[model samples]
Target: MSFLLNEIAPDDPMWNKRGALYAPSGEGPTVWAADDIYTVKAASAQTKGNIGFIEATVPAGGGPVPHAHTDEYETFYVL
Candidate 1:
């Protein structure tokens, strides 16, 4: 099932205090730009700039431009 941007929760309390982060399916701060949807499950601030977990939904033939991360690792999981 697909979820609208506003339908997901904007924030999670567990992220504020450096505690465990847990967001059920279809929950997170979501944004839309460049013809794609980006839902952030774990923000940089929540991870002390160490990591960020985001779920991206891209339409057919749509995706980010080729880019490289200079200071961090990036991974993708196709569902």
Candidate 2:
């Protein structure tokens, strides 16, 4: 099932300590845009499956850093 933006609550505990428009991951509190998309796992969040999304924007001439998934495959669609 699809969800609306307003329906999702911000994971406040995950917010950055600097009070910036970014959140830091555990291992490395790397700066992530406030709008960056994140997913909730089905088992953990009680959904059908793991959810995935993006909430950040690419600066002009900038793109996502190189990365890969070993177990799961992802499909992208542009609306």
Candidate 3:
């Protein structure tokens, strides 16, 4: 897992901390492609390239094409 912060400015304090709280009751950018529901919750810019996250609902017996995420850590959770 390559967690590269290539764009991090040295003058920026790494000790700075921030957070957000949400109930997860909102819709984000969506597209109707490949018969799946994709909801982008957090984007790279929103997290300052620290992370990205999305929610996808694919129908049974259907799935997206193989994909890869370059240069970062990823966490996938199902509820």
Candidate 4:
């Protein structure tokens, strides 16, 4: 397995910034095909034994659909 840390700029265009906060995709979900409404602030991902992290934000009432990972276990902690 491998581990690494990654950073994303809050001002990144991927997350449209409006005033002081970032707005959800104005182009709609088709742009990213994300089922939920959120802005990626950070994440810990694993692919083929490679691990990495990212940062993001999730707007209120936005979250992932109810699903399970068949190949791995997943968990969430409310902050």
How large is the C-alpha RMSD of every model relative to the true structure?
A: 6.3, 12.3, 8.1, 10.5
**At residue 34, what lDDT does model 3 achieve?**
79
Q: Choose 1 or 3, whichever is better by TM-score.
A: 1
TM-score per model over all chains: 0.71, 0.32, 0.58, 0.33
Cα error of candidate 1 at position 3, Å: 19
Question: Model 1, 1-79: lDDT tens per residue?
Answer: 1234333222545444345667558977888878998888876655666877889999999988888878678898998
- lDDT over C-alpha atoms for residue 20 of model 4: 35
| Each model's lDDT | 0.69, 0.37, 0.54, 0.39
lDDT of 2 by residue, 45-78 (tens): 2222354434333455554456787777656654
Candidate 2 overall lDDT versus native: 0.37
Q: Which candidate is the best by lDDT?
A: 1
Tens digits of lDDT, candidate 3, 1-79: 1222334332333312344513154655555557877666555655666766667787887666767768555566866
**TM-score of model 4 vs. true structure:** 0.33
Error of 3 at 13 (Å): 24
- Maximum-TM-score candidate: 1
Candidate 3 Cα errors over 4 Å, as ranges = 1-24, 73-75
From the highest TM-score down, the ranking of the candidates is 1, 3, 4, 2
How do the residues 19-64 of candidate 4 rate in per-residue lDDT, one tens digit apiece? 3334344331221224433323323321223432222245686655
- Best-to-worst order by lDDT is 1, 3, 4, 2
Q: How does candidate 3 score on lDDT?
A: 0.54
TM-score of 2: 0.32
Deviation in Å, model 3, residue 3 alpha carbon: 22
